[model samples]
Target: MIFTGKGFRFGDNVDTDQILPSQYLVLPSIKEMSKHAMEPLLKDFSDKFKSGDILVADHNFGCGSSREQAPAVLKELGVQVIIAKDFARIFFRNCINIGILLIELKEADDFQDGDVISIDTVKSIIINKNKTYTFTPLSNFLKNIISKGGLVNYFSAKK
Candidate 1:
């Protein structure tokens, strides 16, 4: 997948709770869930975000809680790519497990808020303005798993 969208920039240690505040859990659907997405960091973020926008952040992104709902909310808000300097292990896996593309880059901090970015998910390359950076691509096998909608689907298809 090639990501084409505006960028939303943030600093380090963005935890799952901030992504989907606990207060919003009562909502049943991602559509409703998105209304409260990013409530802690950016006021009016939900209404301001455009579909297909990319989220760029510094290290330890999604550092707290093993909440699958975090990714679900971001996906619901139409976040196409999440580029970070580092990701919490569970959150990184959760993104792939749920089909939200997550990537790690050394210079993730360089991206500014509202900068447009184009990501080549397969190549793991990101282009921000005139600069281009390459990230380690997910292995083909892992890509296949994500493409098929996670490990369960990968295994089920073998049955």
Candidate 2:
């Protein structure tokens, strides 16, 4: 799949709480919880984000709690992809489980906030302005999972 979006930039060590605070976890739905996403860092992040927007961050993008709600909230807010220097392992898994694309690139720092970026998962390329960066392509199995909308739907379709 391919995704194109405006980049929303952030710095290092953005933890789970910053993505979706613990207080909002008690909310009934992800839609409600998303309104509070990135509240600590960017007060109006959720309100301003649009579908297909990309999140670009420095290393350890999801470093704190292993709460799956963090990525869930972003997905609910229509964030299609995230590009980071690196990701906390559990958070990385959580994002994949929920079908939110995450890509790691040492060159992530090159992207600026609001820069329009195009990601071709099929080609494992990230294109911005006059530049292009490549990432390791996803395995067919993983690609299938995401295409089916995460593991649950993947397995459900198998039945």
Residue pairs that clash (backbone atoms under 3 angstroms), model 1? none
TM-scores of all predicted structures = 0.92, 0.94
Q: Distance (Å) between predicted and true CA of 36, model 2? A: 0.4
Alpha-carbon lDDT of model 1: 0.87
Most accurate candidate by TM-score: 2
Error of 2 at 114 (Å): 1.1
Clashes of 2: 0
lDDT of 1 at 152: 78
Clash totals for all models, in order? Answer: 0, 0
The prediction achieving the highest lDDT against the true structure is: 2
